[model samples]
Target: MKEVLVLGAGYAGLKAVRNLQKEVGDNAHITLVDMNDYHYEATELHEVAAGSVDKNKITYPIKDVLNNKVKFIQDEVVKVDADKKTVELKNSGQLRYDYCVLALGFVSETFGIKGALDNALQMTDIDQAVAIHEHIVETMKKYRETQDKEYLNIVVCGAGFTGIELAGALVDERPKYAKLAGVDESEISITIVEAATKLLPMFSENLANYGVSLVKSLGVKIMTGCMIKEIQDGRVMYATQDNEELQAVPGKTIIWTTGVSGSPVMGESGFKERRGRVIVNDNLLDPDHDDLYIIGDVSALMDKATDRPYPTTAQIATRMGAYVGHAIAQRLKGEVPEPFSYNSLGTVASVGNTHAFGLVGKKEYKGFPASFVKKMIMNKSLADIGGAKELFAKGRFDLYH
Candidate 1:
């Protein structure tokens, strides 16, 4: 029997394995490897980091998502052996495979900013988000007891999707946190500092202004064209267009959500890449390796119409997984796999629990209407993975104004 190995239990990895299992049942042996026992919803991580959502609500047991036809292995992939067609695992030794799928996710790229790696908190994973929430709780308690404004100051270091969402969620959550800690809500401050000329540069400037307006109304301070120089000792130092020298923004907590790079696996596999991402061909296949395929954050696939790569999101990752799975299945049957094409139904960004903005089918929506659509999209995502039952179980059904 041909052995198939897929690394990472992310949207791409999980979906690929599931689709492959369904198509090539009893004909191939499929095994999925992930370091985590549970698969967490990465899109909802900012809410968890902001202490507004429980981590349990965003995660599901890995076993719960897979079937008996596929074997699951929990271990960190140490290295790739391309010549031998084997993967080096930290605990499980080497795993040999006929076909390999490298869906190994992303790493938070700090851009080599001084003190960032050592001082700033990044909430990309479940553990990181929960840690941020716990830290915020402790800080709020200290602020209540000592009446120290420093303890309650939160400086989020970006204005992109993750940074802006955390900023808005903190706006809504700080009051509750203050109540829990017996402190005045006015004592808390959440600021978003960005180096860009304006927020959400990828989208329309009007949309960015809309997001800024909403967050500003919630008491968030937006610092545009200000570049963060360093994060250290409970203070973030930044520089402005006029003042080149760094100025400090006082805060006990600094959360960095600036950027991400392809996983370390990219360098190990010796794939040709730009900006640490593999530029895959039309089929999302690694042209250099017939036995290997790339997907999700690790890939840089350009849209023919725009000539720009699609943004790495859960939506794109899940689609990439499905495409690769179907491609592999077709190849198994000695047929040509279809070339991958991205179809974006819409994109949405939540400002807080009660408000959001998105472009759906050429129609723009904001406020409760957009928020409602966002929740529906999430619910539909859960249903796609584990059916309607999973939707009811993990879906976000609450509305807080």
Candidate 2:
């Protein structure tokens, strides 16, 4: 029987295993290795951080999702030898593989902004989200005793999807935290700083404008064309639109969601990279090796329509995994694989309970209806990955106002 080893049980890796099981059947031995036993919903991390949803809701056990079809190994991958077709585990012995899939996802890019990495919190996973939630709760408690205005300020150091989403969530949770800590809602402040000239620079200008307006209406300050010079304890230094350097803005908490880079393992493996992404062929396989496949955030699939790489999202990663799974199964049967192509349906971003922005199939949606669509998308992902019962258990169908 052929062996398939998938590293990093994330969106892409899990999807790959699912499709591979369906195609290859009981003959092939499929193994999934991951550092964590649970698979986290990366998209809902901002909501988890804001306390809008429980952390457990955004994560599902890999064993539960995979059942017995694929063997689950809860171990970190220490090294990969593509040439030798072997993977060295942190504790477990090295395992050889007939084929390997690298879907290690991405790490937060601090861009070397001084204290940004050491001081600022990130929204990468469920644990990070929980940490942000706990930090906010603790900060609120400290503010009640000292009444330090800095404790009420939160600076989100990016205007991208993660930064914008977190800013909106923080704004929504401000009143809840204020009530819980016996403080006034007016005392809390949220600010977003973006190095780009406009928020959501990837989106259409009209949509970007609408998103900025919706967030601004939620009492979040959106500062565009601002470059962060320094991030120190209790302050953030930046350059203003006027090209003049500015002093640090006092804030107790700073969240860095500026950028993302591919995993170090890719470069360590001697794969050709551009901006930390492996340069793969159209089939999402490495040009240097035939047995190696890359997908998700670590793989750069070019968008022929735009002449650039596709944006890294869960939707794209899931779709890529399906492709890789099917292709690998074909290869196992001594057949050729098809090239990978992306068909973007659209995107949606939530602002608060009843506000969202969406661009779906050339149609624009906003306000309450868009929020409804966004919630449905979230629920659908849960259902697709786990099941209806898992979605219910995760409390993702909650329509709490």
Candidate 3:
């Protein structure tokens, strides 16, 4: 029997494992590995960071999700030996494999900006979320003691999905937190710093304005056409529009949601990569190695229609998982699998607990209705992972809230 090794238990890795088990259970020994034993819903990480949702609600045990036929290993991946067909684990040493699927996920990209990595707090994983929450709470506590307004200013760097979500949650929660901490609500402020001309620049101008209006209504100040140059102690320096004049945006609590890159394991493994992502062929396999398949943020595949690289999202990873699983099964049967074709469903960006904007096909959705769509997509994601049980346990079913 062939040893099929899968690395990284994020949405992509987990989904691929489940599907691969279904296809190759009788033909292969499947071993799934992840750095963490628990699988967390990454899209909702901002909610966790802002103290809006418990991290437990979003994370589920990996064992509970995978079948008994698949072996699960909780360990860090040190490197991949492509020539030898082995995966190097940090603690458990090496494991040989006939076929290997890598979905190692992503890390924050500071673009080598000064003080961004050292100073700005990121919302990447559960631990980072908890850290951000503690930092915000401690900042609030400092405000209570020192009565310094600087402690009350929460600066969210970048106006991307994570940035907007973090800013909106702070806007929704900070007032209540201030009130509970015996500080005036007016003393707390949430500001979103975007380098773009507007928030969600990918959306249509009208829809983007709608999102902007919604956030502005929450008293969140948005500095558009702004580019941050450096982050200083309790201050962020930036330029407005397309100018050279630098301005300092101050806040002790700085949440960086700028961007993300592929896992470092790609480079360590000697895969031909750019920005931590391996360029894959049409079959989603490395050009030089057919036994190796790369997926999720670690694999950068270009879209044929848009001529741009597809955004790294959980939905795409799930689809890729199913494809790889089927591909491996076909290979085992001595048949070639079809090339990867991506059909985008839509995008739903949440702006606080009760507000959102979304696009499905050519139709646009906004406001509370869009929030409903967002929840539906999240629930569907849970079902895709482990069906009804996963949905009931970790799904976001509170649609009306």
CA lDDT scores, all candidates in order: 0.84, 0.84, 0.86
Rank order (by lDDT, best first):
3, 1, 2
Q: Model 2, residue 324: what's the lDDT?
A: 88
**Which residue pairs in model 1 clash with each other?**
none
lDDT of 3 by residue, 1-401 (tens): 98889899888888888888777748788999998998888988998898888889888888987776799988999999998999999999999999999999999989888999888998889999989988888888887788788888889999887888777778768766696456877678888888887567678999888888888898889887789999988888898765788899889899899989999999988888988998788889988998999998899888988787788998898898889988988888788899998888988888888899878888899999998888889999888876688899877777654
List candidate 1 stretches off by more than 4 Å.
399-401
lDDT of 1: 0.84
Worst 10 residues of 1 by lDDT: 380-389
Native-to-model Cα distance after best TM-score fit, residue 330 in candidate 2, in Å: 1.6
Stretches > 4 Å off in candidate 3: 241-245
lDDT of 1 by residue, 1-401 (tens): 88889998888898898788888757788899999998878889899999888999888888887878889999999887766889999999999988888888888879989999888898889999999999888887787788778888899998888887888789879888778667678768888889988666656777767877888888999888899988888988899999999898988888989978878778876767655678888888777778888888888888888898887888888899888888888878888987888888888888778888877777778888989998988886777655566778988787654
Report how far residue 132 has shifted in candidate 3, in Å: 0.8
Off by over 4 Å in 2: 244-246
TM-score of 3: 0.96
Clashes of 1: 0
* Model 2 lDDT, residue 52, Cα: 83
- Residue pairs in candidate 2 whose N, alpha carbon or C atoms collide under 3 angstroms: none
